[model samples]
Target: MEQVVNMGFISIIPSLLAIALAFATRNTVVSLGFACILGTFLAGQGIMGFPTLIKTSLGTTSFAWVMLLNTFIAILVAFFQKTGAIQGFSQYIQNKNLSRRAVQLLAWLLGMFVYFSDSFSPLFVGTTMRSISDKARVSREKLSYIADSGAAPVSVLVPITGWAAYLSGLAVGIGAIVTQEDAMKLFIKAVPFNFYALITVIFVGLISGGIIKDFGPMKKAEDRAIKEGKVLRDGADPLIGKELTEMEAYPGIQQRVFLNFILPVIMIMTIAIGTYIKLKSAKTMEAFLFVMIFMGISMFIQGIPFKEIMHTMTDGVKGAVPAIMILALAYSINSLSKQMGTANYIISISEGFLSPQLLPAIIFLIASVMAFATGTSWGTFAICMPIALPLAFSFTGGEATTLVVACFAAVAGGGVFGDHCSPLSDTTILASTGSAADHIDHVKTQLPYALICGGMALAAYLIIGFTSI
Candidate 1:
């Protein structure tokens, strides 16, 4: 075990520096890297600690799995684009000639359907629907909002997903839930109470279906798109470059758009779920790997040159490299924080305020703040779960499952809530890239909606906290 530093309040500096730098510079990699270095120094590791930092950051089995899963998904997305599968599907939708409202609704629906991975969902749905949504006069901001909201929120609610696997593992690790089965059961039970996720998902439909009128920046974006025919505001810097935003189907090839796109996705879901059921665990990474292999084979069979295919896959991997770097840095910071006892320090500071009637609300709010600052829901889960779960067990005297469930729900929901709004979040960035929206524009437009849902979720948690007690 790594030695834990007894740094008390000083331990928070690394995280605070990271958060401040991220907000100030809008560069996650730089902020996280600086923070990691500072944290290692503070932990009494000498300058040579850089080697230890790298090893600790990427050496773990869990981290490797996450990296592979994300990288493979990126490759798969590249394959989809290269095969003209995404474009073909977009054309099919265009041929249907659905109304603007219907196109928006379809984009929203596709987001929910692609609930396997949060990062993959937005990249797929946002990129696939960008042209269609643009034609409908939907602002890139709005498209990104729909994509971002749909990604994490839906992933958290669904059981057969990487989010569920990670959450379930955390729950079991807490030892409050003895078995993975029971931990997953608790996760499922908590799903209904994941108000932020549930509300965010429903809110997307409300906005898309025109049941809820736009109230803030989103309204202005929609208006600009409709009246001025500006999909992006004048001089806005979009996250995606022209090469990707304007990528065309490779010329002179038979494009079986559906076959190219749908088959691999279907295979991924089918095989992932089947393998999980057989092995009594989630095979998310394995499933993605299989899908990538299948996609490569299918493309070769379809007469796409091996060289061009390799080039496209490389481009796709390149596209995902930014996100992967963010993930690595996020993980490194989390590790450093752990070594410095940041979570424990925070828990200690807050422990005096804990009460059964207020635990859920407090946990929710804290987790939300942590995730918002860090821009990593998974990291928030890693930090908060160990702290929150034990507190719930002790506070409830180990008997009130309802309270435990509520607290669990709060942590999970809060992470998603913060992730939805955080500009530094991978999913948020992917949404902007996928929709060809300016990163800050996407953040600005989505904040109001996320806050609204977060408010509702906060109210619900308070009610559950007080009433259940």
Candidate 2:
């Protein structure tokens, strides 16, 4: 066991400061940076600890993967813009005169189909649907909400996903979860209990299908888009730079639907899904690299000059710079979170009032707070599972009962709720970038709906807890 650092109440200051600053300034990078500095100083590393923190935090293989992924996806988004694929596709959809409801539902379905990778889903769906959604007068806020809804929430609920395997792997050796097979059974059983993910997906479907009328800030955004035909509100700073979004198609180049957009996306889906099935890990970044190459070559053959292709690629990289910087600092803050024992601090505060009837509810809330603070659901699982599962066992007399699975579901759903709301989360950032929505605007609009689902999930957990007792 790693020795626990006892900073007591002070350990939570960094996360609170980072989140508060992010909301207040609407500038994620600066907020994360300042919070990181504060966290380093408090960790007894003094002023110099900041650099060491960055060096270690951004140095990981995972961080490198995310940075590269963002760059590659940005390049593809730029290529799509430059080739006029999105615009051309929107034109076709316009000719079809698809209703706003149809367009929103289409975006939701597209997001659902791209379930192989959470990172790939939002970017592809956002880039594909942004023009179409705008044409239908769908708010950028609403589009982003659909894109964000489909990523982690959808990914975590599917039983065959990497999410399921990783979560199952986490339960090993706890009570009756003695092996991978044992853990898998328990995880599968807990899927129906993942209320937040289930309800979130359902909510998207209802709203997109126009079954549920828009409410809260989203209703305001939708009203503006409908009444004023402004997909984005006035003065909104979209996460994606206009360099990509506003990049005009090269002159005199024919925009072939198959070559410019559809084929390259097909290639991405094939490569990503094919590899996940055969190799057990999705080669998502490699898929992006290959598609980008295919797209560049295809565009070169389509009469777009070699120089223009190169220029668009450069612009693509530039457009992703802001998101990349935010991600880098987000990683740093998460690292700082670990070193300062933020999750541990939250857990310590909540672990005292335990009973069988309340275990599921409290565990869910703790996992929610932990993931919300750290902005990573997988990280939340890694920390919460070992502690939470064992504690549940103590109450259940070492049995993997319905109460145990309920606890499992609580952790999974709770992590997702927090992940959805946090600005520092990668999926939320990716959603904003994908839909070309303002970063803070996406959060402001999506939080009310996420909280609704979360509240319902909490009520369900409490009901289950009381009945199981």
Candidate 3:
């Protein structure tokens, strides 16, 4: 009877509502906002007391924390751009005179270099490598594809990164079922199974620089770039792009582009190294915070003056306005959904959908669906971990290392796939806007590739499940 009640409550209405908002408005913030409201409603009042939902649902920590973090990250990224550090770095890469293929390969190589500093990976790589990819006529979607793919996957796969440490903590929290060392080992094993990320790296190399058929919308974008002999889309020069244009004129300006570029790189590296060494650990939030501070300092020293620093931060905040709101909304939905017992409700309804022999496949499907619906890899992991890990751990007779690894891989792949397709995703929009490609074009071109990778991962999961069991 209790199980039945939990099942009815856990159907995930809050998540559904969030998904609806995202699609309806085609805005990530709006989708998240609606989801948060739904979560608050669930938490503050029973489903029956719909009228008082708004008044009661005002307090939730998830909404607040996610907003704060988003605000900070956005501001830092914007300030880095305003300081001309990005341009300096891009110019340096272009100066190398590498062929387009060489440029694409270099971008992949650099992503590996910065894998230890997860938060800095996207910004740092995007800041520097996008320039060369642009010059070589790689589409913005492809460049972003490379950047996003490498950032989190590489960070998490390596135990040395902040992400690895974060997962370790999650493992510890799950308690008794798996040790920290075991969790780390499982995480390492899962990397080879992360089909989306590994394949993305390979696809970037093949599709860019004319190695394979660019048959979809991506091919069109590529063709246009080549004919024009430029990286930006027609009428969309990188220098004049809105994000880049806002900070072109500033103080402490380095005439030597190389100096402008190298300084930021050195500063970011210094912060990451310093934090890891000073703390004798890799997982502090301070590591993230310190990197932001160093990034800001480097920009200021490069030529952005104190006055501009304030503006840069403000600009950063403005960029994050949408992302912060969406994050809050996402958290709200989770709070409400869990409060209402929505996840349990769904599990009950779907109980026995997979036989005990097929438990691994069912777990993967659940993780993927949740991730795709929520548009967050971390959220998917957090929610599923509490339920899936415990159940799998119990089912496997306390040896769930392999199952945990599979589940983690599923969520990771699903999240990236969602981000690739989610028109409301911040990274998706940024990739389009950054690369001077049309927003829809990036989505359309990348969707096929993401799907392909996802399929491969699923097949891999099945193979591993059957063999390991």
Cα lDDT tens digits for candidate 2, 368-455: 9888888888899998899889988887899988899999999999998999999888999999998989888999999999999999
TM-score of each: 0.87, 0.96, 0.75
- The segments of candidate 2 whose C-alpha lies over 4 angstroms from its true place after superposition are none
In candidate 1 the C-alpha lDDT for residue 272 amounts to: 68
**Top TM-score hit:** 2
lDDT per residue, candidate 1, 270-325, as tens digits?
A: 77668766765657778788778888888888888899888877776676666667
TM-score of 2: 0.96
Stretches of candidate 1 exceeding 4 Å from the true structure: 1-10, 17-55, 58-66, 172-177, 234-237, 240-243, 395-397
Candidates 2 and 3 compared: the better one by lDDT is 2
Q: Lowest summed-lDDT stretch of 10 residues in model 2? A: 4-13
User: Where does candidate 3 stray beyond 4 Å?
Assistant: 1-83, 117-119, 172-178, 208-212, 224-245, 256-261, 273-305, 325-342, 390-396, 400-444
What's the true lDDT of residue 117 in model 1?
Answer: 72
